[model samples]
Target: MIIAVVDGMGGGIGSQIVSSLRDELPSYVEIYALGTNSIATSAMMKSHANKGATGENAICVSSKKANVIIGPMSIVIPNSMMGEVTCRMSEAISDSEALKILLPLIPEDFELVGLENKPLILLIKDAVKLMKKEFNIK
Candidate 1:
């Protein structure tokens, strides 16, 4: 399966998701990440996605191609957060054939002792579990 992880700016969230899934998921699945910025894509690539891309166009392409899309629930809403995520990105994702696994947890309070954010750990775990069920990974 091809999974897409979309994120903005720093990519802290997307990176964590890619890494955790790569480490825990079976080899059959491929993660394709699209970051709104280069940093986000690179972070996720370092985590072990089969491939990654950055910027607006990448987001649109990945959303359409991925078997599944994973990210914060906010991403579905275009014109949200002052356009950190564009309407094109949101539409490509929402209108595409991919299933989405969204988490509503606030990005704040998501840290692990001076780290970026730890709440995402739980989110990732939950996401993986959901993926397992959704894709029958195991």
Candidate 2:
């Protein structure tokens, strides 16, 4: 299965997700790091992603081929990621025929209710667990 990890900015979150997935998941499950920029893609690649790409078009096209997509809640919101995420990118990711597993991260001007303010590590761990369950990894 291909898991597309979309992230922007410094890509700290995407790197963490890639690291955790590489450590916990079988090698057969490929991780595609789709970044809004080169810096973001490099960060995720350093974390051992199977493959990676950058820019809006890359994200939009790659997302469509993924079996699953993991990233911050901001990914689905148009013009998010400090405006690095464009409308096409958001729409492509949200419209992809993939199971999306978004972290309840706090975005600008919006608070994700019904979610505890957990540590970043804990949130990432939970996301990994959800992905594992979805694929029956165990």
Candidate 3:
């Protein structure tokens, strides 16, 4: 299956996701790094994604192709990531057929309720577990 890891800004979150997925998921699964900028894409690529793409158009097209989409919740919010995420980029990801696994790692303004404050590593492990469960990966 193809999993898209999308991110913006410095791409630290996306890179972590890619690295963990590489270590946990089967070698057959494909990981696509989709970033709002080249810097973000490069960061994820360094984590060993099968492929990488950048900018709004790449994100829109890649989100459509992936079987799963993983990233910060900000990917679905227009004008997010300090204005790097555009309206079209958000819309494409939100509208994609892929199963979305979004991390609640946003600013105070977008804080989610009913979620315990967990470290990023813990949250990423949880996300990886969900992926394994959904994909029936051992």
Candidate 4:
């Protein structure tokens, strides 16, 4: 299945998301890194995404053609500071018609969850894993 791992601003949380996914998903699964910048994509690339790209097309791209889209719940939040996740980007994903696994952890001030990386990753890890199980992706 094709899964787009979307992120922005160098994918600080995005990379953490990829780390968790790396632990859970086997290699056969298709993983795409959709970042707002090249750095974000590179971070996920280190996590072993099959492909990576940066820009508006990351959002405008088709989702109906993919199996699922995974990222922070904030990705849907328009004009958020954590990333340059513009309204148009959010709209593109919303229109994709693909199943999404979004983490509800809003990081106190709508920013990255500071130095508390472990807990943040754990929260995302558990949530995504449960969602994947519910969807029977295993």
Candidate 5:
């Protein structure tokens, strides 16, 4: 299956997600790194994503092709990531046919109620676990 890991800014979260997925999933499962900037894409590529693309159009096009999309919750928030995620990018991702698994990392201006502030690593692990369950991966 093709899994897309989307991220922005420094891409620290996406890199971690990609690295964890590389460790947990079969090698044949393609990982597409979709970054909002070149630096973000480069970071994810270093984490060993099978393919990498940057910018809005890349994200929009790749989202549709992905079987699953995993990223921070801000991915669906227009003008999030300090404006790195545009409205069209968020819309494309939100509208994509792929199953989305978003980590609850929101921007400072936004707040989500009733969720524990877990460490990023734990969140990534939980996301990966859910992905395994959803795709029936061992």
Candidate 6:
């Protein structure tokens, strides 16, 4: 399956997600790193994504091809990621048929109530676990 990991603003989150997926999922699963910028894409590539792409066009195109889209909830929020995420990019991701596994992280202006505010590592682990469960992997 093709799993798209989207991120921006340093790609730290995307990199971690790629690394964890690489370690947990079977090698056959394709992990595509979709970044909002070159720096973010580079970071995820360093973490060993099967492929990487940058910018709105790349994201818009890749999202449609993915079986699952995983990223911070900000990915679907227009003008999030310090404005790196455009309205068109957000729309494309949101409109994609892929199942979305969004981390609750968001910009300061917004709030996701009732979440435990777990650390990033735990959040990523939970995401991977959910992916496995949803797809019935292993």
lDDT of 3 by residue, 93-124 (tens): 99999999999888557868899989999999
Residue 133, candidate 5: C-alpha displacement in angstroms: 0.2
lDDT of 1 by residue, 1-138 (tens): 899998776778888888878887888788987887787788888888898888778888878888899987667777654567888888888998988987663344343354244476897888878988988877
Scored by Cα lDDT, where does model 3 land? 0.94
Who is ahead in TM-score, 1 or 5?
Answer: 5
Q: Give the poorly placed runs of model 5, Cα more than 4 Å off.
A: none
lDDT of 5 by residue, 103-131 (tens): 99999999999999899999999999999
Per-residue lDDT of candidate 2, residues 13-130 (tens digit): 9999999999999998999999999999999999999999999999989988999999999999988878998999999999999999999874679976677898989999999999
Q: Rank the candidates by lDDT, best first.
A: 5, 6, 3, 2, 1, 4
**TM per prediction:** 0.85, 0.97, 0.98, 0.80, 0.98, 0.98
Clashes of each: 4, 0, 0, 0, 0, 0
Identify the superior model by lDDT, candidate 1 or candidate 2.
Answer: 2
Global lDDT of each candidate: 0.80, 0.93, 0.94, 0.75, 0.97, 0.97
lDDT of 4 at 81: 43
> Candidate 1 or 5, higher lDDT?
5
Q: Name every residue pair that clashes in candidate 6.
A: none
Candidates' RMSD to native: 5.2, 0.8, 0.7, 4.0, 0.5, 0.5
Q: What TM-score does candidate 2 reach?
A: 0.97
